[model samples]
Target chain A: MAVYTHLGAEDLASLIATYDVGELVSAKGIAEGVSNSNWLIETTGADGAGARFILTMYERRIELDDLPFFLGLLDHLSAHGAPVPRTIHCRDGDAYQLIDGKAVALIEFLPGVSVDQPTPAQARAVGAALAEMHRAAHDFPMERANTLDIGESLRVLQHCGGNALATVDPALPEMIDHAARLSAAWPQGLPQAVCHTDLFPDNVLMRGSSVTGMIDFYFACTDAMAYDIAVTHAAWSFDKSGGRFDRAIGRALLAGYESVRPLDPVERQSLPVLAQGACLRFVASRAEDWLETPVDALVTRKDPMDYVRRLHFYAEAGDNPFHPAAD
Target chain B: MAVYTHLGAEDLASLIATYDVGELVSAKGIAEGVSNSNWLIETTGADGAGARFILTMYERRIELDDLPFFLGLLDHLSAHGAPVPRTIHCRDGDAYQLIDGKAVALIEFLPGVSVDQPTPAQARAVGAALAEMHRAAHDFPMERANTLDIGESLRVLQHCGGNALATVDPALPEMIDHAARLSAAWPQGLPQAVCHTDLFPDNVLMRGSSVTGMIDFYFACTDAMAYDIAVTHAAWSFDKSGGRFDRAIGRALLAGYESVRPLDPVERQSLPVLAQGACLRFVASRAEDWLETPVDALVTRKDPMDYVRRLHFYAEAGDNPFHPAAD
Candidate 1:
């Protein structure tokens, strides 16, 4: 839970005036994501109607230049009817602008609850939403290379080993080697499209097993769409501890994804390695956060061992449960 | 900003079932206050109506037995049309219950914006609301003693002297001495009532110049009504640095309070000492928090010296601003 930036009422009122959105009624910081400061803002429309929105102030971690891709992707996907927030345009015909020296954007508030441990049905709904977002953003004009690609993952893993990771878990070095091997030999991609790179369970909102929306598109980039499926599977099919895999939920999520856009034979065959890469991505990121983040930071870093165990599960499995046969 | 207790969706759903509120739609952890975990909960009502409520999970600092007094005071005040959140009772007729080993309660969501540095008009509105609440809660059946009374203040002052407070500011001891003197010489009986002991700027919500609500009554207790005014005066009439007092706002606040219930001569005479006591309470508590809170806590510990400076200003002033003739 974080709200890194604080804005005063007068500053907020002036910021609101720069947009077509009406008078600011209230803005309360929401402690959800770790990447940026988010506030739930309410305004009275010029027509005297009421509206609610989410005002995001990009923090230090996010690259300012990359915001256009994130905002444009949301704009493109929402226009295509995907379950995502629609960016509210500013008076200057841009969805993103500067407020108090930080890049700020407003998006319509999406209504739905994010669960810690989703039921199998809810897992499938999330899978369906990811697929929907992937399809919707396929033709998005912007492109951003994944910052934490295989090479970056290797760097993070090395950093973790040199730092305090071994003290936390002695198996980290060996796990890094295994992940490096899989990432180095990653299969040739069969399908590429816009993808939500970090579709964690908390990013998908559900209402009674129905997908309401997908949020936190900061990591969205042009990547192998099948890799997105693998990431979402890792997100939804894994238990909270990530030590155990739920095959039933994995199959359900795959089925949900297939309902929208079926995986081609090559894509299906690459699921295991892709899943390994996804696990490695999280493992390295979590390790870095655990080692690098200041003790005084208001962030709760996930245990890297959780992803370490998940990577092991992926390594031990000869074939993906969702795609049993190589194509 | 705190969300100390994390509740899973299944637990939340079951908890909602115990109430007639409705189907759970969403629950976002609100990053606002430092004392408790707060979630902005939305539900589709049992009758298919939509509603939003605040779900507060009481943290360790709060006493469980004192919850009845706090919740009952809100209930009583809101029932009498004072601007405060009404506690929502569960189907079992209890307003307080436990979820995930943490005591929790749901209250109706009041709509208004809370500001950091309130305008003079806004400060007056807040003062009016505080006065209204005091009048309405006068006959409240339950009573809790002010935990930060003169004796407690002296103890906290002593604790501050022995801690790292000197490292933060060398003048702390002198300020502590001054505060101790005022607290030890607190005036004898004036008007007493159930008071909202902490009426900080962030605790009051405003729409334009009108106060929409008063919140965070965890500190409410049986105390001198004049002391409550003094506490609020300290909260609203002082700048963040606490070095300079805004006399116009202070006068406006006193006028607003007098509009609802006039201050007796005895109460008026007690204002200076009471205000001094209020400053001391915040100074000691903030010092304790600064010394004890973990470095990684999500909370921002207020500088104790801000209150110390305010205590100094209160000490040096020959006349109470509220009582022009008194030194």
Candidate 2:
């Protein structure tokens, strides 16, 4: 609620007229997303006579610098025949426009409902789609985004040690400190690739039992490809209790990913530790955020132990046993 | 940063003369906390001769109704000679004041530095202090707070099922549903007592290896004592990788607590599920908050899986193994 983008009816109608494929029919705000202002635009045109698209006003509250990359990435993927949304170019031949101080983009709206919990088949399809996207964009040029590096992650975990140990549990600091040291000692020198930094289940769309498309590339950036795989594994492998990783699902996902683009031995070797690093990063942030929560916002209590346990899981496992398909 | 509370040097001197304290030699803001503005007031007066106190402007963001209960609880504990800051009675012997649209209070500041991590002895001391505080407040009268009972918790988990199952692991929703069902079936007849809702490590202060004081009682309210223990256990027992619970630390904490105040049989029986419930509550809140993070905060990504594993741990454990020392 800190920032918002609003589009008036007249502006939306005028904007819709510029698109060659559709006649301006109706536009209404979609209430789904919390981030950007989305309008479901209905168009009647000679091509299909009737088609639906989403007109989005980029929320200034989120990083605006990454907008071009996300939109361009989708455009590139669509051009390569990937089952992704096609960015609707404006009359000026631009994929996006600056309107009313917000970045505005129109994309062909794919028909599907977001599934809360996807079955193994759905997860597998997502894994496959992600692999394909990674392969297709392997050479795509983009600057690195997130500021965090391995050293920064290590520093966060190290900082938590003092706070963790000083409480009712005296042993947590040493354990976190040890994990930080171990993760720091992990071997480096892997090739970096474009990664969908935020690949939570909600970001992927499912049609029937299969993933039809992937969305939300706002966090996508140039990073270690294995780290993305690690993120995918972490996202997909945990059971509801979140206590243990599901080996079957892990295998299914890895198999699906390898079917499209296989991971090298070094990438495979670094995964478990990368996952641990991911866990540590989240824990440290949550811990710090917990301390900073306004006394009035007492409803928000950061659960530091979640990442703590996840870090432990990666440490104990040493390496992920599931292998990507041997292309 | 939004509100300023300090008076000018001349104004502060004039204000000091009206109070019982002889003279305020020095006063400065404590910049550590993100909430309430705090000033370390050094005063020389006939009553205490030379004493230092912390004057705090209670943040309006916190529930104003609950402020009296927290102030009373602190006053009651200090009066009982507990190792807590003593609230200083104002000119009219009141413990609080309305200053510049905010609640303000002054308390004799306990001498100690906030330690990052405490040794085993420090943890034990905190455990003992918490137990003693609980025992002392057993008969203190207060209205019940946080009406979202056990049933509400079950409802949230059930509602989150679709979202939980649709991600990487389909089993997570099943586990949450199972825990919810099991928790629903369990008997609930535990006695209620005053509980410190937020007892994380940083909230406790230490002088060397000894815990000198506990602060931040904004969430203190009447709740099940076993729930408080569960909160403590969850806070204290996690190992470094954050994947496993440190049974040794758990045992030590329980032993330390029981040395001062013992848990009833029924209370002991309910601890595990309560701990699971605590885990569930945090996970649910975090998951909801994850959807709300400003797209721009690019500062951190909140991982929901961390809590899933914790809930699984308590569910697998089945029952709390904690026992108090023989008095």
Candidate 3:
């Protein structure tokens, strides 16, 4: 709902006509995904057989140039025996196409429902999967991507005026001001790699306690590997109250990742700050988005303080403390 | 620039003509904003010679329907003596206009350089200003805004697929799963009020360690005031290495906020979890945005994890421990 794809059943039908894979039985929007338009496509062949695949209309909201790198990485991972969706070729023998001005592709559906919650064992499996993917992706052809230089996030905060500032209890502005200054002095120059920038639990698919597949490759790029690890730690370790970090969970994830592609000393050393950076980026962006969202789009409210506190924790810890729980 | 407003200069000219107040001496783009095209217009002649105003091309990236609320709020705050940009009427005596499919408006500008950082005393001033604004806006009429609903954020997390999940360490899926389950039993039904959805440090302007004004009203809407306090705390307080919490700063901020507007027991009770929820929202969104940004924009990188850890901290504490730093 964040984007309007200008796609409809008719457009889908017309597009599918050229792909002689099979007679289309039905296609409907799947109730998953926040960034792209995804439809579960069911098809019956002339031979009276059937198969299911996910028809995804790549979000134009994302930069189109990055598509090849993302898909290529997925292909590379899949070729290397990573658990990922296999790109189904289109009628033109291409794995991807531009349909209705969006990067459209068909991916063979992986079996298994998304687990709402996972046990520690399942968490360990996820660690293993990620470690394996990072290890396999080391030879990804594209170079690493850098942080966006444009201060778009800073600008967003600037857009909300006095009223927004008023809501914050008294001393916050100074603390923020201090952090902003200190942020200028934050460490730089870290080792880079093919980073899965948006890894979180929901992105992984499971069947009973085993991670069956990993999906969504859009944010994949070359960046600091430690950043990727920090992202994972942040996403995996926090509890529901968003209050405490679960040491066991953090250990499992890191252990899983390290088992495949061992972290260098520098990567390990910078993990905490990398985590802090992740927190700042989100807090800044969410605050801006919260300010920018239209008054009535059925858009949900976002709390800006959660990440603020999280950043504080990472600042205090100063390093990754948990060993891999999976091992 | 994310958006291009075709007629920025022309729109400013139109406003000048309508207001019949002054002659424009200079207009230049202010590069500090992310969502809208802004220009500083120096004016001379009628109402006040040697005066300045800001011409803004409303960003179309925002939900168009919400412009009125934002602009109207600005006007209201200005009327109540809050240091804000006063809207200048159009030739037809309207506060806003459409030019080249963009919302265009002009407002009286405050003249001062934006201080990048402010001292703790200034932070207190910011807190006091916020209190004044909240007090002024307590009865100002506006519809409901973002409520920081946890359900929607959880839904988005669920859609993040393996590509996104893999980027995170495996342990996160379990942690998220646990959080989702625990969230069902979390407290609800708290008092709500108008909140500034964003209040980061950069949004406030200071002159010689004195907070002169608060700017940006795009995210201002009706929500819990504590959420605003949490947002401020998140923005202001930080630990050393810029990842941990500074208790003194937190105290200063909270003291400033509570001085003007006393928080009832209920609001105080909700602060910790509200802070956690805020962290989750930022982490989830940053993860999603990381996935969506174009790989080539050089504008993309992993979000910081500080906020995630802070969430854990708050969860562990299970209460707000903020107190004013003793002068």
Candidate 4:
């Protein structure tokens, strides 16, 4: 959401020189991602001109050991013909470079904008891309746990306590109780794969309802594929604050997912509890961030109550939206 | 330093539509300017493709009525063959458009980077560009009073008082007395023009030793052109935090300015006080910002002590840097 690191034009040009990309023309800091800084880099190509890429500086919430996996996953996925951008290795074949003790990498810049009010067509394209990413990540020769899962969510939520939740909203403290119920009902032994756990609308880049790129893989990890669908459903099927649900977008997203990778009957039935867990996961994290984030962080703190509304909807309705009632 | 507004992709594409530039391909938020949100916009050119522009959304510290003067100054200078960007008017010929009750405009994107550690040649180029801008701005219809002048600086510094200055540096309070002396000695009426009062290294975009454009005109107003030189000298001739002075860069900058338009003998003699006034101007504002800027502001609170050190340097030896001492 903001550029935290201030790299000079010389440092950037030298870093770009590490690769085969010609001289740096311009680098503009992009307003994207919460935990890292990104720049849209334009350069003179090796032979011609106007080659563009994304330069990212890893800032926080990621460790040195995780760099290989994160950068490697892109190489693997893009190798499998997914629309994900490839991590451009340095001339020495290293995945990332260290500058002032921080890791930075150049990535292929995939064109298209992340939608705000995603149409049914856009939602469908994103669903299809998510499924494709899951398939493409099949042989990605590495593993990282879904660290921000239900257990992590509950831990963070409990830390918020009743007093802090009261500051955000009166009803937020009640999510602690509801989270416990979801934790108990949370299933095991369903279909699983390397899932893009945070595939919100903001992550999927689209051009006229055609999915061009799925980006920001810092939160990506090995997890239940069905749970990934649940996260996407909870994310894209509602208005920004989760106040209103769009059934068409929901059905289109689900159908698009099924068209590529059909869900098992168990996966279908589990959607009810999974969506609730997805919504609760947000409730816990948003509440923690609301309490703990510094006032001046470039991030916009999301209201925990937004997910609270979604959790209530999932709790009461179950899988009604998936069936797609005729309008 | 950070993007304050979040414009949707649809809103931005439509905004681009207002101009004859093609459809919006991408808009990357640039970390430029303290009080405005700027995006480096790339469009599919109306005839060809890949035309670039800068989209600016004014956020704070600038009034709506002042926009015409600011935007029109760029138009006036560029039309007169100064190395400045031209304002791209909307289809209805409006200089700026209102979106969500905020003003935004498109300007030609100039190529080159704002230098970090500027070389003497680079400083010289910026000096020439500044002088050219001052001359090109002649006969600009609109007039804006230099609001943040010596009087305003004194007012802000006085408000900070001893306690606030102590927080920044114990010596900062002593600047108030020095500012008063400079205020009393401040000479009246030197040669005046539309001055780009902020010609810092960061404001002048350069390709090697050549200046591509002079930018960030929000501070432009009808004022003493020599005072503008004083401001630029103070800004570019010192290192960041004002710890050390670069004599070659300082001499080159002044020489470059004289090459364009030689200073009046009266203006040359007034350099000492005008330069001290320039130093005090920043010390006052930075101290006020250091005291009052909110904790969560995306801006990094600059050390007022930086400018205080510069004030001391100018006070101890007036205008010596402008005249080169043989090595």
Candidate 5:
């Protein structure tokens, strides 16, 4: 949720020197990334004008061995000319450098802001961006399993215990029941592609409804392409608490995704269940974090009930939420 | 310490239009500032090239009424050709616009890094910059008393109680004793200037060894200029934990300030007491925060012992620390 590593100017200067980027001018810690430290690095370019970059230090919830896959995906996506920032390799041609036993990488800075209350057009653009990324990542050389899958969600919920979940939110215990139902009804073997499983609005960069970049590829993995759409829809269609559903934005997202690669009938059919599954993913994770904190701690932990609301919305709305409304 | 406010792109774009600086290009939440939300804002210039600015949303630990003094000091010091950034006036000629009950201001982004590990030359530059600010702020219209002075420190310590302090560290109550002594012998009315009382290394931005910006004037007030130097010394001259003191940095910093505005005899003699007072200020604040947290909580609060160590160092070294060391 915040930058865990405290990098100094001297440290940053030495790190930037390895990238063939000119002298380091400044590095500001960006208040972003869930389990990593990110800096908006500025350096003198070959033309003496300052160049901007994002230097990410993998701090937590990341394996050092998985660096090649994450960095390689960005490389593959960028090489395919998707709107993804390429991972800048060091002079030694390495994707990342191991500093103090943690892996860090330099990424090209793309211009744009991440819209929280995205317009319908912006939603469509993000949908298109995801579809394009799916196409670009179709032939990526490396592979990693989606570790936080249906089984894992159930395991986490069980680990949290029903009483603990109830303590956090009265409705949270029912998420376990929903997870079981989702597990039984989960779709099997549709179309597969590399999925940006966490394509919330924050992971997207936009300028005037155009997506300049799709970032934070740490959670990316080989998964059902339709599941990615469901995840993005579940993410962008609702308010943070999942109390309000924007059907227009939801339709725009699906239309934008379909605009690039038209969804198969099978993919469309699996969406309702996939969306429910997506909701449960957040439910399990947020519940674990919520239950870990004391009952009265002032620490601002995310409410798992947010996802519980989304799960119920999906259950009640079914396929009707995806239909486009007359503007 | 972190961005507490979540400003959406729409919120930022509308905010930027008020400043008349440029069209919003991008805004990143900078992981800086102790109790305010800061965004590293980028906007397109009239020349069509992009420019950078820091947009701050005053969240907590700041009074809305005191904004004029804070922003006005920047405008005053900037006009006086000090290396401080000027506040960008709104189209309506306001220094800061009230947004949803919180005051927001745009400031010219200065180029430099907030060095955690500062060089001797860098320390010297920061000292010179402080002296320049003191001279420039000699006739500023607004005046705010040093609220977080020795008196406040003692008050906060008394509020925290001896048991709470002892629980944090065995020697924390010793800080109370030292603080009392400093309060009893505290110098009265020698010299007055608008002092940046919290001139830590992070507050002073640097390019190589040169100081480009002296920022984060939230704690600026009319206080002893010598006390400002002592605050900067207690801040910049020691490691974060205050376990180790750098003699070269201390000597260089004092010499640099003396170069700009030569220290009076009384001021020079009072450095040790002022430095100890500075450490106690930090100790009081950190102790309060530390005592408020649960003993087993994983929250990474700053240790008050860090400043406690510095307080002890000042007590032992006396005036010896400020004198130039033999090469």
Candidate 6:
């Protein structure tokens, strides 16, 4: 949402020299990635002006140990020909290094605009891309378990329950409690795969109707394949306010995903509960964020109510997992 | 310093069509200007990828009337062969238009890095650019009086006088009072010209030893040409923490200005007072900004004490205006 750290030209130039990249011409702190400081850097090589690349300095929210997993996953996906950014290694072959006491890396800049209110075709493209990414990352050696599983969701819910939220609208806690209960009883034994846990519309880049790149792999982890599909459905099927679910977008998305890799009967049957769980996870995290984030900090705190409405939508779908959208 | 607005692709693409710029490929909100929302837009022309341009949406701080003068001054200087960006007019010949209730315009994106801790050569380049801008803007039809004059400084002082700032240090008021007195006694009627009042290092871009462009003309106004030089000197000479003023940088800047248009005898003699006035202006504005800006707003409110230190430096110079530095 904002560039938390300011990098001077001299400091940036010296840092860029650690890579085999060309002479640094300029770097502009672009407002894209929220958890890290992202600068769009331009350099000049023997051929004159070179291509642009993103120089990212991982911020506080990202753990240092988890970086290798994310970077390796990007490399693995890229090597397998998925439309994902390849992390550019340093002169010493390390993909990232500490600069000014923060883990920093340069990645090949993906050229495309992100569609927020995506069209059906764009949603379909994103669905296919997500499937491609999941397929490509299947054999990625470095594995990290999902951090925001039901366990973490329950933890956050308890944390939120202690706060003043428990006082205002008692039904809020009741709803989250009911969703957690449903998630606890839900079917889990689906094909396990590496999934982009945070596949929001803003994270997917598109050029016209084609998906050019998928970014922000910090949240990537090994999770249930159906759960990943459910998350993607939650992201793509909702409006900006995150209230009304668009069936056309959900239909196109599911069709596109199935076009690449067909879902098993058990996975398909778990869609409604999986979607509810996904929505519940977001609601819990966002509620925590809304309560915890410092008002002075320069980050946009997403409304927890968006996911609340999503949970309501999924609850209405009941046991008819595929329902009006995916069917 | 931060991008306040987020525009979707569809809205931006429609906006791009109003101009002759090619198909919009992407628009990244580059964190540069604090007063306005700026996006670095890339497009693809008939011959493949086109050049990058800056799209600015004037925010609350900038006055509506002053835009024409600022835009026209850029046009004037650009036409006079100065290395400044020309305001790109719309298809209907309007330089700007209201979009989503905000005044928006496109300008050619200037390529270069901004040097905060400037070397002597970079100081010279910035000084030369400032002089060239003043010379080029002399005949510009639009005229904007200096907003932060001695009177304005007095006004801000009185305003700050009302706040709890007066209770912190009694000496605070005295220092500002003395600086205001010095400013009040500044020489009058000394070669009035269109001056880039806020010609800080951040406003001037450089590549190697050469200045690629001068930008952010929202503060440009007709004032004592020597006053502008004084402002530029304050920018080029100071360190980041704003304690020590570099003599070498000041010498190079003055020399560079003289190469373009030599300062008159009166202008040369009036340096110390004008420098004090410039310092006072920043002190007053920064004081107001510090007191007024909400802690939540994504703006870097510069410490007023920095200019307070500069005021002390100028006060020590007394009548020996060209002591150790400008001479």
Tell me the number of clashing residue pairs for each predicted model: 1, 21, 71, 2, 3, 0
| lDDT score of residue B240 within candidate 3 | 20
Please provide, for model 5 over A128-205, each residue's C-alpha lDDT reduced to its tens digit, 9 standing for 90 to 100: 999999999999978899999897899899889899888887878888787888999999989999999999888898
Give the TM-score of each candidate: 0.96, 0.45, 0.47, 0.96, 0.96, 0.95
lDDT of 3: 0.64
lDDT of 6 by residue, B24-142 (tens): 88788988887898998888853675768899999887898888888888889999988999999888998899988899999988878887678888878777887888888888887
Report per-candidate TM-score of chain A alone: 0.94, 0.81, 0.85, 0.96, 0.96, 0.94
Q: List lDDT for all candidates, in order.
A: 0.82, 0.65, 0.64, 0.85, 0.88, 0.82
Residue A190 of model 3 has an lDDT of 73
Interface RMSD of each: 2.9, 27.5, 25.8, 2.8, 2.2, 2.8
DockQ of each: 0.63, 0.01, 0.01, 0.56, 0.65, 0.62
Candidates ranked, most accurate by lDDT first = 5, 4, 1, 6, 2, 3
lDDT of 1 by residue, A1-327 (tens): 688777876677788888877788877789877778888888887576878889998887888988888888888999999999989888889888887678999888988887877777887777788788888887888888888777678888877674366766787777667767876788875678888888887788778898888999888878899888888888878887887888878887887888888888888878888888888888888888778777676667788888877777877784757663322
Better of 4 and 5 by lDDT: 5
Give lDDT tens digits, candidate 3, residues B1-327: 222343333345555666666665534344335578766555564766556566778875567787777777777777887666667776577777776677777867653333323456666766776776777677678765673456655666677754574566443344355348546754566656556767766567554445556777777878777877877777677652236776666776777777888778887877876777766666566666766765553243455355566666767766745533233
lDDT of 2 by residue, A1-327 (tens): 111444544466578777776565544344334467676666675396667677778875456677778888888776776667878888788888878677888987764434445566766777798888787777676665655545665676566557654462454566566555756676577777778866766566555556656776766778887787777777677753347767767777787788888888888888877887766656666666665555454233556666666667777777744554321
* Distance from true location, Cα of B32 in model 6, Å: 2.0
RMSD of each: 2.1, 29.2, 29.5, 1.9, 2.0, 2.2
- CA error at residue B131 for candidate 3, angstroms: 1.8
Docking class of 6: medium
For candidate 6, what is the DockQ? 0.62
List runs of model 3 lying over 4 Å from the truth: A1-327, B1-3, B6-11, B112-117, B168-175, B178-189, B239-242, B300-304, B323-327
lDDT (10s digit) by residue, model 4, range B14-97: 899989888887677777767999988888887865788999999988899999999999999999989999999888999998
- Report the lDDT of model 2 for residue A109: 72
* Native RMSD of candidate 2 (Å): 29.2
